[model samples]
Target: MEHALFDDLVQSLKEARAIAHGQMPASRRIKVTAPDAKAVREQIGLSQSEFAQLMRVSVKTLQNWEQGRRHPTGPAAALLRIVQSAPDVVRKTLHA
Candidate 1:
């Protein structure tokens, strides 16, 4: 509704279009790859239910991540990385 805000929005849309068409490079880019949930679980020697419980997520959510229907983000992604690299630490910390 404000004039400045509207102008800024239009400028952003133009920038996005230019980026989409490769007319200009994006200002920033970030790439985050989701972990393989099933492999992490297998490496930890845990069942789906057990892994889900440890992750503090529902079994269906775990299944979604495992099946590639969805991705874990933010804290979940960080935890998955930890589980992959140092599963024993996770197990000890969580079981304690």
Candidate 2:
């Protein structure tokens, strides 16, 4: 590895350690909010089973998201955002 790149990685590790220890503040913070599953399903006029099928998830998984027992992460979370913002497009593309 290049000397400069190695030094940067070491610095990053130190910074991460300091942040974890609460000795230093993060340079930036990002907050992601999950969409409400039930609301999105209702807005799309789909029942739980239909919505679960459309989302490619089991009804229990959908229920967990709706009931706040579990939260969707990664791609599922992104899909929920897309569905919330553009229900018609998703319904036309995925439901049809």
Candidate 3:
């Protein structure tokens, strides 16, 4: 078979293996640091929705983070800590 066709077949098999494990096809991830959702928003003069947009997360996720309906994990928790330290940095980075 042509090299291009062989490569495509290999890629397809990788995808099929991932689907068999019930995972979405993989890709890169973004890293974000956040602050206390409520405190960070208040500090930056934004509401939950605004903050969510700035952070590229959903409003519901922000609300859940604030209300303790859900917890921020991994990089999210780290972001919250970063925000707690310097909310201005968080704001700037949000738009950046």
Candidate 4:
């Protein structure tokens, strides 16, 4: 029937679109979710200057992250979270 044929065509188009967009049927692209940078810094028991020193980034960068003026991306974002949960791990990784 024409209705059945149209349904098949629509399904095929959807499959093609999903493939073009690199979706795996139901998976979405990974978004890096970061915590409150200021809170993370505080938890590590460091002032802005001290934390920036430990992170090896400028204090302005830390301020931007905390204020959400910019978000950390890629390895920096990953390391920020690691620094939040396991500071020793960050220290070891950085020094290593």
Candidate 5:
């Protein structure tokens, strides 16, 4: 049983190496377009300070995003996408 488990582990590692080296094609690729932070803010009719406050980011960070000097990632990026898709829903949810 122990030998079987080791064999399975070795097979898994080999598959992983193949995938890493592009010997195996990935099943699918997900493409996520980063939101246009400045456009989102303008569409919502919020000033930079207000938008920054609502997004829970520092003004400088928001400015960076707006200016394309930096990009938002992780949860912040996710939230911005949500806002872009459903501005009213996000506004109601956040303001509520």
Candidate 6:
């Protein structure tokens, strides 16, 4: 039993090393596009203030996103994508 455990550990270590050195390629990759805040707002038919309120961001931040002066990151970016894809769902969910 101990020998089998050691063998498994060694195999795991070897696989980890191979992955660390890029000898093994990852199995999958996901590509995500960032949402365009201005376009999303327009599509949803919301003004800047309304959109900013819905997004829970300041007006300045929304302006920056609209003008391409700055970009959203992390959860904000994810939420924007969701909002872009389904504005009604997002609106109902958020308002609820």
Please, what is the whole-model Cα lDDT of each candidate in the order they appear?
0.92, 0.92, 0.78, 0.84, 0.90, 0.90
Q: Which candidate number would show the highest TM-score if scored against the true structure?
A: 6
Local accuracy of candidate 2 as per-residue lDDT tens digits, 7-84: 999999999999999999999986556799999999889999999998999999999999999999878888899999
RMSD of each: 6.0, 3.5, 6.3, 8.8, 4.5, 4.7
lDDT of 6 by residue, 13-77 (tens): 89888888999975665656678889989998999999999999999999999899999987889
lDDT of 4: 0.84
Kindly list the per-residue Cα lDDT of model 3 for residues 22-74, writing each as its tens digit.
78655656555545678777877887778788767799998899997887888
lDDT of 6 at 50: 98
What's each prediction's clash count? 0, 0, 4, 0, 0, 0
TM-score of each: 0.66, 0.65, 0.55, 0.62, 0.66, 0.67
**Clash list (residue pairs), candidate 4:** none
lDDT of 1 at 79: 93
Clashing residue pairs for model 2: none
lDDT by residue (tens digit), candidate 5, 1-96: 699999999998998899899999866766566699999999889999999988989999999999999999878998999988898998888889
The local lDDT score (0 to 100) that residue 89 gets in candidate 4 is 82
Query: What is the TM-score ranking, best to worst?
Result: 6, 1, 5, 2, 4, 3
What is the C-alpha lDDT profile of model 4 across 2-43, one tens digit per residue?
Answer: 999999999988987987887846445676777788999988
The residue pairs that clash in candidate 5, if any, are none
TM-score of 3: 0.55
Say which prediction, candidate 1 or candidate 2, comes out ahead on TM-score: 1
Superposition TM-score, candidate 4 onto the true structure: 0.62
Residue 87 lDDT (model 2): 82
Clashes of 6: 0
Q: What is candidate 1's lDDT per residue for 1-96, written digit by digit as tens? A: 999999999999999999999999999986556589899999889999999999999999999998889999888988998999999999899989
